[model samples]
Structure formats: C-alpha cells, structure tokens
Target: MKNKSLTFRIFINTFLVGTLIYFVCAFMFFGNLYTYFEEQLFNELESESIFLEDYVLNGDLLKLQNLETKNRITLIHSNGSVYFDNTVSFEEMENHALRSEFLGAKDKGVSKVSRYSSTMTEKTLYFAKLLSNGDVLRISCNQHSVWVLVLGMSQILLLILVIAVIISGISASWISQKIVHPLNSINLDEPESSDVYEELKPFTKRIAEENFEKAQREEIRAQYTANVSHELKTPLTSISGFAEILMQGGTDPKITVDFSKSIYDEAQRMTTLVNDIIKLSKLDEKSIAMEKEALSLRSICREVMEVLSASAKTKNLSLNLEGDSGLINGVEPVIYEMIYNLVDNAIKYNKIDGSVNIKIQEIQNFAGDRNKVILSVSDTGIGIPYSERERIFERFYRIDKSRSRSLGGTGLGLSIVKHASKYHNASMLVTSEEGKGSTFTVVFEI
Candidate 1:
C-alpha cells in the first residue's frame, strides 16, 4: 500500500465501502423476509384449524379427505384412542395421549408444536384444538427444516453478491478516474492557470509560487553571467593592447619595459578575479572539505591583522585587536579567511588615520544564561547606506564600483565572508551610518 498509486488505493477503498453497505442491506432484507415467511406459516395453520373444526361440527367428516392434500387432519378420542387419520390407517397411527400438542390442547383448549421428523431433513408443525364433541382436533403440516431453508436461499444470495461486486467495481473505477483526472491534467509550469478541484487550490498556488521563485533565480544568474564577462573583458583587453604594443617594437627601451609591466599588472588582476570566481563557485557547490576543531577566535583574528598590517600602514589606519580569548569549533583556515576579508575591507575603505578595532568576546545567552562567542570588526570608514546593506553580500555587488575597482579588491571578498560564516552556523549583524562608521559582528554559537 505504501508504494501503491493513488488511483488504485482509491478504487480499493471505494470497493470496500460499497461491499460493507451491500452486506448491511442484505442482512436487513433477509431479516424482513424471514419474519414475513414465519407469519404466513402461522396464519395458514390457523385457517386450516378453523375450517376443519367448522366442518366437523356440521357432521361432514367425509369431507376431511378433501383437505388431505393441503394438511394432515387427525381425530383423537378423549381416552387417547385414534378415531380418524388422514395420512395412515387407524391401526398404525400412534397414540396421541402423550403428544405435546394433544396434552396442551386438552389443558389449554388450543396449542401448537413444531418438531423435526425422524429423517431430520423435514420439520412438522402441529396445531391442536378442543372441539365441541370432547374430541381433540389436530392438523399437521410438513416443511423443510430451518437449516434447509437457509441452504435453499443460498444460491439466490450468491447471485446477488456477484452482481453487487460487478456494480461496485464499475462504480469504483468511475469514481477513481473522476478523482485523479484533474490532478494529472494540472500544468506544473503554470499551475494556477489550470482549472482543477477546489480542494487542490492550495497545492496549485504553492507550486506557482515555487515556479516564480525559480524564474527569478534564473534571471539573477543571467545578470551575474553578463557581469562576469564584462569584468573579465576589461583586464584581458588592457593586457592584449599592451602586448600588441610590445610586439610592434617600441622606439624606446624604457617605454617597452613600462608596457611589459602594465601587461603583467593587468594579467595579475585577471588572475585574481578568475580565482575569486572559482572560490565562489566552490562555495556555492558546497564542495569544500571541512574539518572541525577547537580554535582560539582571538588568535585567528590576530593572525589576520598581522597579515594585513602592511596594507593598513599604507592606508594610515590604526589597526587594533582587543578582547578576551574565546574558543569555537570551526575549520581554522575558513575562520582566518573570514577575519582577513573583514579587516582588509576595513583598511581599504577607511580614511587616513582612521581606527579599525577588532573585538573578540564571549557572549552570554539571554534565555539560558549560556556563554557563546562573538568576533566583531568596527571600522571608522565610509559606511554603507541602509538601502545597500542587504545587497552588499551578493556576489559582484559594490556600493562604490569605481572605488572598489581602484582598491584592487575583488567584489567576492564579502560574499566569501558570508559563506564562511554560514558554514560555521554563525549569524552576521551589521550596523552602519552613512558618512560615519560601520561595525560588522559575527556571532558564533559554540
């Protein structure tokens, strides 16, 4: 049933329900039929008894033979002597003194008894009454036993059941088709446009929303592809132009050397851009092998600062690391890369003599009073506007495109930081006021 299709399951369910209903109706009909037959049997006995007693009082005992074909009429004397018998000779007739119906009639004026015959295949119903001549009048009728009666009707019941099964199967197939046709006809690409059952409206709307989102993602990918081509072409064109100049034989040796140098610089920029793009692709595919170990957050931050100190010095920015030691479980290189990008961006965007503060501290949980770790970088740089903050983490996005290009910074640095933070199950919080300073905080729940 777990692997069965919906149509088959629906068919089975409908058939089962129909079968139950059929049995219930059959039981009720059989009950009423049995009751009606029993009542008719009793009425026949009563009418035969009344007719025989009336005939005997009129002194027409010879007419008793007329009723022999319908029922057995017996005459018994008060002293238990068999006076007249219709089905047998008077000598062979059994004594009626000890018979249930006879004894009952003598005491109660009228009585009836039903008993199985000697062969057990037949039953006889006897009705007896006290007549005006002080004689007991008895009428007996033979019929099939109750078990035989049930067996006789079994053939008819089996036929009805077979017909019911055919009808139920047909109905089940028709109903299952009616239920499954609309689902099969639904257009997945534009689900809401299809007219289906009212019960399926919610599912169709959900599919529509997912398709819309998928379309938007495809459009974004197209734009990103165009951006990557444009970004790569600029440097490649510059390098090609300079190489062409060198190849054509420059008039001065110094000028030729300058051209070679310019070509090298453009080539390096293109190489960096291509490498960053590869890294972004790897991150998107989640292909990086990660090993978790307990790491000192403060030490990683210090190492990032040391590597970027020369860049910070050139910018005339004061780089500082302050806070307590905090331990976290993460991939060491990924954490270092995350911190390096943040500090590098701080120095690149800061004004001369601006301060870049690194804070590593343990955060206390408000609900459970548990201790967690946080690493924050605060920079007195040209901060981002509120509108651009959300898009800043998107690949190839920039607040100041020209300035970002001039700084020799790949737009993927912040994107890498975001991916790395997410890999460690960390949350990034940003606070910035344009023309003031920005603080980027990475909270780790280790």
Candidate 2:
C-alpha cells in the first residue's frame, strides 16, 4: 500500500470520502422519511376518530357496522368495558381499563398512543376520543417499524448505493488523473521552465538545481580529460623525438647529452603534471583522510618560500615574508599545497629581478576581536586581466599558454589553491592589473 502510485492513492482517498458522505446522507434521509410517514399516519387516525365520534353519539350502530375501512374502530364504555368493535367481537377482546390511551382519553377528551407488537417489527397507533355519552371512540392502524421500512425498500436502497459507487469511481479516477498529469508531464532536463502545479514549484526547483549541477560536473570532467590528454601528449612527443635523435649513431656527443637532458626534462614535466592531477582529484573527491589541526600560516609560508627559493633565484626574484605568524585550524598538507601553489605562481609570473612578498596577519571584526587570519601573496609580474580573473582557478586554464608551459607550470596550481581554501572554509580574493601585478589573498576564520 505504501508503494502504490500517486494516482491510486488519490483515487482511493476520494472514493472513501464520497462513500462516507453518501452513507451519512442516506441515513439522515431515511430518518426524516420515517418521521414523516409516522406523523401522516397519526393525523389520519385522529381525523377518522373525530368523524366517527358523531356516528357513535347519534346511536348510528347500523351505519358504523356497514361502514368499510382498513382502520379498526372500537367503542369502550366509561368504565373501560368494550361495547363494540369493527374488526372483532367486543366480548372476545381484552379489557381496555389498564390501556394508556383509554386512561388518557378519559381525562383529556382525546389522546394518541403507539404500541409495538411482541415481535418488535410491527407497531399499532391508536387515537382515542371521549364522547358526550361518557364512552370512548378509538381508531387504530398498523405500521412497520423503522428497520422494517428500511428492509422493505432494501432493493431500491441497494440500487442507489450501486449508482453512488459507479459515480464516485468515475469521478475519483478522472480527478486523480487530472491531478497527476502535470507531474507526469514535467521535463526533468528543464523542470523549472515546465508548467506545473503551484504546490509543486519547490519540488521542480530542486530537480532543476540538481540537473544544473550535474551538467556543470560533466562539463568540467570532459574539459579536464581533454586537457590532461593534450598536456600529456606534448611531453610524450618531446621525449619520443629526443630519444629518437639520441638513438641515431651520427649525432655529436655534446648534442646527444643535450638531447638526453631534454628527454629527462620532458619526463620530469610529465611526472609533475601527473602528480598535480592526482592532487586535484584527491581534493575534488574529498578522498583525503587527513584530520585538521592547528597550524601557522606564517610557518607554511616560510616552508613554501624555502622550497621555491631556487626557482625564484633563477628569475632573479627576491622572496620576502612579513607580518605575524597567523594561526588557523586546517589540514596541514592541504594547507601547505595551497600556499605552495600560490607562491609558485607568483615567482613563475614575476618579472626578472621582481619581488614576491608574502604576508600573514590577523584581521579584527567591529568588536575588535581577532577572528580571521589572512594570507596574501603579491608579486611584480604580468598580472591577470579583469575578464580572465574568474577562470584562472579552472583546471588547466592559462592566460598565456606558451609562457605557462615554458615556465614548466602545470596550470592546476590555482585550481588546487581554490579547492584547498574551500576545504578549510576559506575564501580567496584576486586583485590584478593586466601588466603591473596581482595579489592573491586567502581569508580563514580562526
């Protein structure tokens, strides 16, 4: 039952409600009908009793005896002795002294009473009137009890029930289909644009959100695959060409050595690219099991500068670290990778003899409480354009592809930085001019 379709449930609910209402109305109609019939019978009996009282008063016994009617007429003396009866001989009938209608008519001049038979399925209504001769005239009739009346009309009532069931079934089915049609017609790919019931707008909106996210993920996955293939192919082609040249016997020793070195460099480049891809995959998938701990941004900066110092020296770039040892709670290795990537990008893009400045500091809120730590890396380099700043953190996205490749940059550095910062509930801000320089700031809540 719980697994039934929506239409089925709707139909069942509608049918049950309709059936309930029908039963309630049927019982009420029967109740009022029974009351009306009983009242009509009583009124007829009272009128007949009034009309026949004159005949008994004028001593018209022959006329009363010859009269024909379905009702029973009885004449009782003032002392409750039966004088005459239409349906039976007065001597054969029981005494009426103890009867409620007899006593009531004797005192009130006229009275009415209903009595049920021993079987309880039949009843008799009596209207009695007191006469001028101190005798009583009674008119009586038989009636079926309420349950008997219902039983007598069982076939008609059953027919009505059948008709009701048929109508209710048709109405319920039609209504359920009308209600479910809009949901069935929803286009999952563009749910938000589909015409749907107002009550279901929130439901369709959720589907739209999921669809959008799925499309984005698929797009990113496709681009990442294509980029990885192209990036890997370049190094493989270089290594293959260099190895081929080195294999030829006529090559000079110095040139052969240079070719071998070129092959090794290409291999190293491919290795670096593979490792970066792996790191990004781990970060994206949340596959890393490392726990977060208290760490200093200043300490991490010092380590990144030490690792990249040689590369900075080659470009004649000065590496400087300033400000306090900003503390934060974060995964240590992920934090290290994020800082390393930012500093590396700075040094790689800086002009010859340019300076890469690393700063770590605490920021205070309006209440003067130091609740945030900021790490900003700025460099004197060919900075990013406003239009391209947003996409800089995309996987393998490079503004200057040739310069980026020449610098042995894998192009996933900023992407990794973005993911890692997000993992630590941090936000990254990029401020750059096309040619002057760029500043990358990561803000972390402590």
- Which candidate wins on TM-score? 1
lDDT of 1 at 206: 97
> On residues 1-446, what C-alpha lDDT tens digit does candidate 2 reach at each position?
68579999999999999888889999999999988988899899888877698899889977888889999999999888898998888898888988999999999998889999999899999898989899988899999988899899999999999999999999999999999998899999999889998899999999999998999999989988999999999999989998887777789989988988899899999999999988888888776566989898898899889999999999999999999898899999899999999999999889999999999888777486548999999999999989999898988999889989898987899999999999988999999987789999999987
lDDT of 1 by residue, 1-446 (tens): 58478899899999999988999998788668765766677678878788789888887878886665568888898877888888788878878899888998999998878888887788888888888888999888887876677678999988988999989999999999899998999999999999988999999999999999999999989988998999899988988888877788844899888888888887888898998787667667776677889999898888888889999998788888888788999988788878988998888888888989999898777788556798899999999999989899988888889999888866888998899899888999999988788999999996
Spell out the clash pairs found in candidate 2. none
Residue clash pairs of candidate 1 = none
Q: What is the C-alpha RMSD of each candidate to the true structure, in Å?
A: 3.7, 4.1
lDDT (Cα atoms) of all candidates against the true structure: 0.86, 0.91
TM-score of every prediction relative to native: 0.85, 0.82
Give Cα distance to truth, residue 90, candidate 2, Å.
9.8
- Which runs in model 2 stand beyond 4 Å of their true positions? 1-3, 56-120, 126-138, 159-163, 170-182, 185-198, 363-370
Sum up the clashes in candidate 2.
0
How far off is residue 429 in model 2, in Å? Answer: 0.8
> For model 2, where is the 10-residue window of minimal lDDT?
361-370
Task: Report the C-alpha displacement of residue 224, candidate 2, in angstroms.
Answer: 1.6
